[model samples]
Target chain A: MEKWRATSNLRRSLKSILNRQLSSVSEFRYLNEKRSCQSSFNLIRDCKSLGQVNAIQHRCFSSASTLVQRNPSFSTLNSDDISYFKGLLGEKSVIQDEDRLETVNTDWMHKYKGSSKLLLLPRSTEEVAQILRYCNSRCLAVVPQGGNTGLVGGSVPVFDEVIVNVSSMKNIISFDKVSGILVCEAGCILENLISFLDNQGFIMPLDLGAKGSCQIGGNVSTNAGGLRLVRYGSLHENVLGLEAVLANGDVLDMLGTLRKDNTGYDLKHLFIGSEGSLGIVTKVSILTPPKLSSVNIAFLACNDYSSCQKLLMEAKRKLGEILSAFEFLDTEAMNLVLHQFDGVRNPLPASMHNFYILIETTGSDESYNRYLY
Target chain B: MEKWRATSNLRRSLKSILNRQLSSVSEFRYLNEKRSCQSSFNLIRDCKSLGQVNAIQHRCFSSASTLVQRNPSFSTLNSDDISYFKGLLGEKSVIQDEDRLETVNTDWMHKYKGSSKLLLLPRSTEEVAQILRYCNSRCLAVVPQGGNTGLVGGSVPVFDEVIVNVSSMKNIISFDKVSGILVCEAGCILENLISFLDNQGFIMPLDLGAKGSCQIGGNVSTNAGGLRLVRYGSLHENVLGLEAVLANGDVLDMLGTLRKDNTGYDLKHLFIGSEGSLGIVTKVSILTPPKLSSVNIAFLACNDYSSCQKLLMEAKRKLGEILSAFEFLDTEAMNLVLHQFDGVRNPLPASMHNFYILIETTGSDESYNRYLY
Candidate 1:
């Protein structure tokens, strides 16, 4: 236990140091004027510091309230509705506390705020279905929340909509090592799955900066193109099966672990990337690739966009299957990261290049990857 | 010109030699009782020799005629329909020849045969759209054919239905070397695309025995999981974008080559693996991996299924990313292959094993791959 604790502490420290060095080099966002689209909504968006998000949100979205008016069709949440939810899913599962409401009612950037009075935490798909059924009959508007790390105001409640967070539904159902397929509940955090797979000699096909908080269900819902996308494709590719719940409380069990199913329409993909508007994803069956022993990251500087493109082509041609990621950021984004975030020492501090590229490669042989580099 | 011809000749000769040596070891089929399921329907299936298919199919499916009854809601082909098709897509495009119809009507296994009297070859998506519009208006049942290499009689028409073959639509559209994205008409033969990508320093993610004859459209429509599925994933992963013509002649243009796009429903996946039931895939934009220089195949003898599973798990772990294919067949299947195919030689001729396992590895570093082996 002592040895495990020491190793865990060392690994965490290493990860923190690594994040400081490379978190700024997340997936490219083409220099957004407002905030560089800091940390994507998907599972694998480039990592952004929470401090940076806070700093920007405070200055922006002062007129967030004027964006949209509340719909009259949505019935007001009353004491009776709250009582019904508490009866269905225990009183503790239903939240009316302002402090907790404040956290769930707001977006990751704290830009989009809502006046939602209730938040429901369902531990199972059945509970979620029951809650939805009640809400549907009452004509109450509801919003499904995951990790709440989205930048585009997707996770936040727009008005007085009740928030249904799946954080309580986290559990790994089954794992097939022969096939490297994992079945996990919706609320399982991305980092948790990654670590679990890491111990099992496998790795999740997706990864991102928000992995520490982002749920796998949220990743599937948003169809996140994460850090591993340059190599592993997308959620549409890695997700083998999905179990989602429709607004009317129907559990759309499209979940099948088979990789070679062509029996009928692959309806599971419809819920993927639909952002929980179609259904709240309850479970996910994803194809995880085996973890490679050797991984290397190369930091490169390019003079221009054309040079970056050229370099990308060369890297693809040379790196082949081992290439896991090819992420880039402009000099302006780099300057912002350095100025806003503390302890993010620039890799290329001597002279600022027009563009910066971060390339990652993973393989079985440490020596071979090093030699190729 | 002479030097180029010599190089081409050498490549052809080498490929033929390689195919002859490895074609028998395509994929695992668990000692298929009737015919070993010869090859898969999708883009990636175990490649079976033409001789093996003919030998088994001649004996099997003797009662295939009585399987599916034609729906009475469909109209029979008439002279007016023929004239209309000829007017829209030339006289040569409308094929009534028994010789050609006989070939297209029969599946690769020769098990299921259709009685379609007319076969229409459309040159473009527009032409296909027009043909479908006319057919829909007339209530004529039409079956789309691509390569006619699908197992289980999918490509074959039933009960005098119009056969719309997309062979004439074969055309390479655009290829982004940096992105390694290839956009091509569905009728482009799988072998042709493989060769094209080979020249462009890339490779199609899917491969099967029928690659020489199978069309990309058919591959996408059936969602073929070919030899490389163990490494590159299914058509769901590699197919970045798709264009399909719905049953009512409406064009579903869901084609977008961008790796990350989460705007709305990813409807393209519904078309994939739907087996042309939903729509006919006209064009495909697929993600091709960069061509690796070194490829090695290992043939092993296993005593039991348990051992095979163990080996597969080990290969996934030890071999990691380089492991492309892991196919196995029992001694009975091997005996059938040896008895059926004339020129094929057994890799393990000294003594019979309970099972034979074949693994393929691809990598950029030749020496590294060799060392790992």
Candidate 2:
């Protein structure tokens, strides 16, 4: 009875945590306020004139409390530069299309916008290398973009720099069923990789809300720690190795698919979470876990914050491997969710609780999972 | 009943794997031969002449097929250098004692030995920085020594380099129980940290045969992937951050306990497995998993290596989180363990199995673990 009560409290905390996370689609994560931190991408898209776009960008940057000025040192993109890129990447890959550039120039949140004039899509690593080489010698600043789904202003160029997108390089290089290792090109979408692994009776070690559009390269570059981090750990744990390209066009082939990292100086980790600053991750090798058979979820409530913390600790220690995720949200966030979305009802309407938690457990046996739940 | 039979197969394989690991203490891991690949450390200890030492070193290098010659540019330790170190550190920290040098010069395997002239024990990171800074200016190469328990020849000096041991700097800086993060100095013994975490109701992410003698610094330096790697992960995964000192006396404070790694360039990983070439790790911030309540072990047998691999994949996927470890050994290794150890008796005496396997599972409920087993 005591264990059951503790578990109930744990479930409540999870719901609360999850609620907070959902509301965190705004700029900051886990903001305590009940209000939805809305994304301004729609607002940016609604703007008509170029002057209006600048006004919106200026206002958003000002509201964010950080203003970045464009460096005067960077070279402007010229016809000669375009010719070199077009010759190397072919005419079709050299994207001067205004519509595409406008879309790619803005961030996912629509808060940050860049004034980049040209976008280059490279199908092969060799082509990406040549593009970077030419850009480097000419002192042309480049933004190594992957999917352009980044919430941060990292992917988009701040000025008239050229954008290098690796979306065309998307390819599943290899997959080892026994080891559950997947080696893929930088541009592979997270959703595609997830689907491919699902077919193989394995799952990617990570799953996030942005899986639909986020590229595997962007995920690696940011070292994405998603919902499954509690179960599978971060990219640091799952990623075996990766290949990256330097500004000088040096392809650092640190990609090794070994589970055991006994090799000297794990250089790939330097690229992971670097957000393409150190180098642009070209290819990735990651270790995926096998997909389990059954999953069970529960929603419960806790009295206080301390109880929530205790419940999580108990779940981590006691539940061990079966505990996949434990998320919680405070009363305000839960109330906001109930009020904001129509047709959505509260799971626990019995009483006004301080916190709500959701606990999810997974196992191989369906019957066992249910019984355990 | 079919599940029981499969589990039975898993246990036998575990026994076989454990057998193979037991013999691996000598040298090469998973060597299928019945004969022991003995360590020559005791033999080196008995050597009376420097000529014999040279012959042993030469033979070992030649047999390994990798000969590393000493660089002539590195200056030998002199009295002035000794005086400088003594002034920088206290008199007792600076050691020219031949007896002490002999012990720190050889690895745990005794397969590799170094001829280091001086052993300097620094009490703090600052002292370590100064020592390196002086050594850098003088072009006096130095070997950073930890617990001196490394199986590979990474801990010892190749030639007459200065030995910088961090034994005196052992300290548990801080531990956050909520996060299960331990921040400790480089020289703290692995076993000691394990004990500390065990008292706090948590466990280290890794465990190995050399835990008693190995230092956490050396483990991080080599990126130690130990027995619990199947359950947890490597140091690359568990070690959240670290503090390192470069040869030019530049102290890089990358030590952070935050589980979220959104920061730029995880530079600590570069030092993790660089074997002290890039820099020497001074402090570590590692995430430790919570200690579970129940543990179950099974010894089973299988016919072939392919079956063992299949069983492991099933255990990893199906059993999921509860499956802590899956180890196996071939018949030859089993025979060797039984033949070598007098008191050791085979649990599966009924039949001569081709492969033996061991499966371990842990959970919160004792009843649940037994039921699952």
Q: In TM-score terms, which candidate is top?
A: 1
Best of the candidates, lDDT = 1
The candidate 1 chain A region of ten consecutive residues with least summed lDDT is: A38-47
**Interface RMSD, model 2, angstroms:** 21.1
Candidate 1: where is the Cα deviation over 4 Å? Answer: A1-67, B1-67
lDDT of 1 by residue, B1-373 (tens): 3433332333333233223212222211212322211111111111122222333445364443433344444567788988899899998999999998899888889776668899999999999989877876777767888999888777876567788899988899999988899999999999999999999989999999999999999999888988999888888888888888755566666678877766545667867876675567899999898898899999999989999999998998888878889998999998899899999888776776899999999988788888888
Best by DockQ: 1
DockQ of 1: 0.32
Tell me the tens digit of each residue's lDDT in model 2 across B1-373. 3433332333233223223322222222112233321211111111112223334446545443133444444567788999999999989999989999999888778876788889999989999999988987776777788988877666876667788898888899999887799999999999999999999999999898889978898889888877888888778888988887766566767787877656434657766876665567889999998988888999989988888889888778766878888888899999899999999887986688899999999777677778766
Q: Could you give candidate 2's per-residue lDDT for residues A250-315 as a string of tens digits?
A: 566767788775543465775688667545788999999889888889898999998998888877
The DockQ-derived docking category for candidate 1 is: acceptable
